[model samples]
Target: MSSHLLPNLTAAHLFEAILAIALVFSCLLGLQVIRERRPPAVTLAWVAVLVLLPMLGVLLYLLFGTRKRWELRVRQRPVIGCETAVRPFDDAHVLDRMLRRLALPPALSGNDIRCSWRPEVARRDLLDVIDGATERLWMFIYMFEDDASGALVLDALIAAASRGVRVRVMVDDLGSFGSLAAGRRALEAAGGRMVRFKPVWYALRKRMLNLRNHRKIVVADGQVAWTGGRNVGDHYLAAGKHEWLDFSAVIRGPTALALEEICRNDWRFASDEPPDSSPVWVSGPQGNACLQVLPAGPEYRDDAWQTALVKCCFEAHSRLWLATPYFVPDETVTNAVLTAARSGVDVRILVPHRSDNLVVDLVGRSFLREVQRAGGKVFRYKIGMMHAKAVLVDDTLAMFGSANIDARSLFLNYECMVIGYDAETVIPVQAFFEYAFARASRGVRTIGQIRETLSSLARLLAPLL
Candidate 1:
C-alpha cells in the first residue's frame, strides 16, 4: 500500500473506534436511566436522546442528567433530630406531619417573623443584622457582586470580625466568580473566613457543572436569621431601572437555630471542617408565630421540597397564591394547580412580565396558559423584575424562601424554605401579594399563532432546562 493510503486508513480506524466506544457508553447510560425509575416522560426523553445522538447525548447526560454526586454521598449527612420546642397550630398539623415523615424539622411556635417587600427595606434589614451581631455571623449566598452594595455589606462584616465576632461567608463559585477574590482577600485580612461551594473548576473536573448552591441565608448569633430570593447586589439593594422587587424575612427565636443547622451542614460540605455546635437558646420564645425550616437538594434521597409544595396545592381549601420570578413547573405541579383551580379554589400566580432569561420566559408561557385554562388567574409584574418566591395556601399556611417554581430550583440546586402557620406570618405575606397584584397586569387570555408555536416548542426542552 502507498504511504498516503496507509495514513488515511489509520485515521479511519481511529474514528471507527471512537464511534464504537461512544455507542457502548450511551447504551450503559440508557440502562442506568431506566433503572433509576424517573418520571415516564423523562425516561423516554433520555432513552431517545442516547440512541439517536450518542456523543452529544453522552456529553449532555454527564453535565445535567446525573442526579447525585459521589462526593456528596461520601460527605457527612445533614444534622437533624432537633426537637420541636412548641407544637404547631391545629390547622397545620397535616403539613407538620408530612414534613416530619420526610425527615425535616417540625414546626415550632414562638418565632417573631417580619417580612420586607421593598428592596431598600430588605437592604436595611440585612445590614442591621450584620451590624448588630455580637457573637457569630454566618452567611451563604449564591451571588455576591463587587459593586457598591456588596462593599457596604462586606465592610460591615469586616468591622464585625474586627470587633471579635466570628464571621464566615460561603458563596457559589460560579455565581459569584467575579467578586470572589476581592471578597476573600478583604474578609481574611479582617480575620474572617470565606469559602466557595463547589467551585466552578472543581465541578467541571467532576462533570457536575449543573449543580449549584442557590440558597441565600444569613444567621446572626444563632438567634436572628434571614432567608430570601435576593442576593447581595446593587440591583437587589438600590431603587432604579435595574432594581428587583424581592421578599425577605427576619426571624428571632428558636427557628433561627434551625436555620443555623442548615448553614452548618452547607459549610461542612464546602470546607470539610466540622461546624461548631449550635449555641444554647436562652431567651426562649420571642413571639407566637409558628415556623418550620426545610432544606432540600440533590443530596437527599427524594424530592422532599417538591412533594411538600404539591401537597400544599392539593390541600388548599379556599385559596392558593404563588409568586415567583420563574414559572416553568413539572407535570406533577402543573396538574396540582389545574386541579386546585378546577375544584373552585381561588388560585392565582404572579410572575415577572419579562425575566432575565428569554428561554425561561417562553417555556413558562405554556405552563401559565394551562393554569389559566383551568380558571387560575395570572399576573405579570410590570414595575420591575419580580424576584420573590412565596406561596400562600388559604390562611393556615405560608412559604417564602430561595426556591423558585422552576425545575432548576426545585430539583437541581440547594434550597431552603421557611413555612409559617399562623396569622403573624401569613398576614404579612398576604399583604405583600395583594400589593404586587394591584401593580401587575393581568395575563391576556390569548396569544398570537407564532408565539404559541414557539412556546410549545420550548416546552419540549423543559426537562433539560
Candidate 2:
C-alpha cells in the first residue's frame, strides 16, 4: 500500500507531513511547559517562541530551557558526607530556620569576621593563611590567571604541598583552562591535586555550560576561610587598566567549618570522589559574631541568595547600601529596592563608573534614572572598576559574596556568601562602603541623557545578557 503511494506523493503530501511533525513537537513542548511549572512569564514566553518558530524554538528550548540537570542529580542522589556539621543556637531566628530547612547547617555563633577592601591586604591575609596551613588546604576559584598575582598564590600552594600538607584546588573549567595549562602545573608537580569543575566538552549538555561553579572560596586547616569577589589575578590585586576594586571577608570559628563543607561538597561533585569524613570544628566561640554560609545555585527550589538579598532590602529600617560591579537586576529585584526607597528607607547603589562588560554596563545605565526617580540614589565609582559585591542593611547585617546583581549570578551560577549579623563585621563593611562612596560621583545622567534609542534596545535584550 505504501511503496507506490510514496513515489506518487506530491508537494501537498510533503507539506502535510512537515505540518504533522511540527504539531507533534509543539504539543510535546506545551506539555513540558506545564510539567516544569515555571513562572507565568517564562512559560508564556516559551509557548510564544514555540508557536512562532517551531523547529528553532524546540532546539533552543531543549538546549537551555531544561531545568538544572546537574543540580537535580546532585540534590536527588544523597552523598555519603552530606551530614549536619554545626548545631543551632537557642535563639535561632527566622533566617536561621529557613537556611536549616534548605539542608544548610545552622547559623552558628562565636565567629570572627574581617572585611577588607584593599586587595593587597586581602592577598596578604590569604597568603598568610595558606603558609600557616599544616593539615589541609582547599581552594575553589572561578579564575586563576597566569600573571604575577596568580603566581604568588600558586607558588604558595606548591610550597605547602611539598611540605607534606594536603592541598586541593578546584577551578572552573572554561574560566581557568588557560591558567591551568600555564601556571597551575607547578602546584600539581609539587604533589597538590587540582581538578577542573565541569570542563568544556563537545556534545555536552548546553545547560551544563551555564551552570558553572562561580564560588570563590579558600579554606586553611579547617579553621579559616576567605571568600568574596576577588579572583587570583593581577587585575584584582594590582592597579592597571582593567584592575578591579574588590573585597573579601576573612572568616574564623564555626563559620569556617561551614565554608569547608561547601568546598567538600563541590569537590565531590566535580571529581566524583568521596569527601573527607573528618569533621572540621573550632575550640569554642572565638568572637561574638554570628554568621551563616549561604550557598545558592540552580539546584535549589528557589534562588536563595537573591531572595535573601531582596528580603534584606525590605527589612532595612535605616539604610540599604549595595555595591556591585554589574547592576543588571530583574524586575523583582528592582521593584524590591524601589519599594524600600519609596518607603523612606535610604537606598543607595554604587556601581563601577565603567564596567568590564559593555552590554551589562548599557543595561545597568537603563535602570539608573528609574531607581533615582523612585528615591534611590545611584553613584558611579570615580576610580577603577568596582568589583565588590556587598550589601549593608542599617548596622545589623553585612554580606559580601561571589554573586553579582546580575541575571547569571542570581539565576544560573553556583554562588556562596557569608552573612554576618554582628557589629564587628558590619562596621568594617560600612566603613569600606563609605570610603568608596566618597570617591563616587553622585551626578549620574539618566539613560535619556545618554541616548535613549541604544540604551532602550539594550534594556529590551537584558534577559539575554
Best by TM-score: 1
Model 2: per-residue Cα lDDT over 103-128, one tens digit each: 76567787788778887788888898
Following a full C-alpha superposition, what root-mean-square deviation does model 1 have from the true structure? 2.6
User: Ten residues in a row with the worst lDDT in model 1?
Assistant: 73-82
Q: What lDDT would each prediction earn against the true structure?
A: 0.85, 0.79
Per-candidate TM equals 0.93, 0.89
What lDDT would candidate 1 get against the real structure?
Answer: 0.85
| Per-residue lDDT of model 1, residues 1-465, tens digit only | 598699999999999998899999999999988875566778899899899999889988887787655356323233343345657446457978888777777787778999988888888899999998999999899999988899989899999999989998999988898676876888889889999988877877776678899999999998899888889998888777889889998999888888887887788788967756544442478888888988888676667678888999999989999999989888888888999999999999999989898888888889999899899999999987999999999999899999998788767888899999889989999999999999899984578899889878889877766
Position 364, candidate 2: lDDT: 85
lDDT of 2 at 78: 29
- Cα error, residue 447 of model 2, in Å, equals 4.7
Task: Give the runs in model 1 whose Cα sits over 4 Å from its true position.
Answer: 2-5, 35-37, 70-92, 275-283, 448-450
